[model samples]
Target: MLGDIWNATLKGMNDLAGSVGEGAREKSLALIEDWLEIFPQLAEYGLEITSFSMGLAISPSLNVELLGKHEDWSDEAIAKRLADHKGEHSITTVLSTIRTAYRLQKKTQAPLRDPLILKIVVRISPEVRVVLGQPILDD
Candidate 1:
């Protein structure tokens, strides 16, 4: 079961690459690689480091818009869309991509007030009302 899940994750990443484009795909793959290197613990959950791919439906990052932005839709509609999409997109992949983007932007941008800086700050914020009462880090 674990092997199958890992294999699927790799294939999914590859699929996502094809969906985007060569340039974006390669960048996404690199970010996933970095994530794999740091999150050795994910192996226990079936995400093997050796199984990264570019074909997955994985988003390149976690900006809310990247995940799915529908300005006209109500919150309930958005929630439903997310639930439907969750089966196709892995939250782990999104989180990794977002973190990678943040790191890159931090290094490339001058000063701390660049536009990308704000985006990164908002992207990783766990302060949204949904989890406000929960602990930031779970051990």
Candidate 2:
């Protein structure tokens, strides 16, 4: 039973990952960059940015509801550490933050429509810490 659950969970994660593809990733980044481009002077402020992988891993919708709180991290290094740790408290904290951001950005609308990626992001996100608002690279 335990093994079966694990397998199911992994499959779900894959499904979620597949939905938020390269196109969505690029589109999301472009949207954010356009939003931020207005403030060229604020470039030094290290706005924590998150990738599609991390966002999907932590399916922000469930996380926000679970934690009931959110806070931003200062840097990618700290975000990565929070994501890697397995402690319940740490996971909850990270998930809460991601969920809050997810809601704030209205990211759920699209992902929810795609069951596969939505499943992956929601199931795997508790273990991932995502920084928001990173600069998008020109492709």
Q: Clashes per prediction?
A: 12, 15
RMSD after CA superposition, every candidate: 19.1, 19.0
**Using Cα atoms with residue i matched to residue i, what is each candidate's TM-score against the true structure?**
0.21, 0.20
Model 2, runs deviating above 4 Å: 21-23, 29-139
lDDT against the true structure, each candidate: 0.38, 0.38
22-123 per-residue lDDT for model 2 (tens digits): 546565444434333322211122332222332332222222111111232333634564556446453345435555556655554533221111111223
Name the runs in model 1 displaced over 4 angstroms: 1-20, 41-55, 58-139
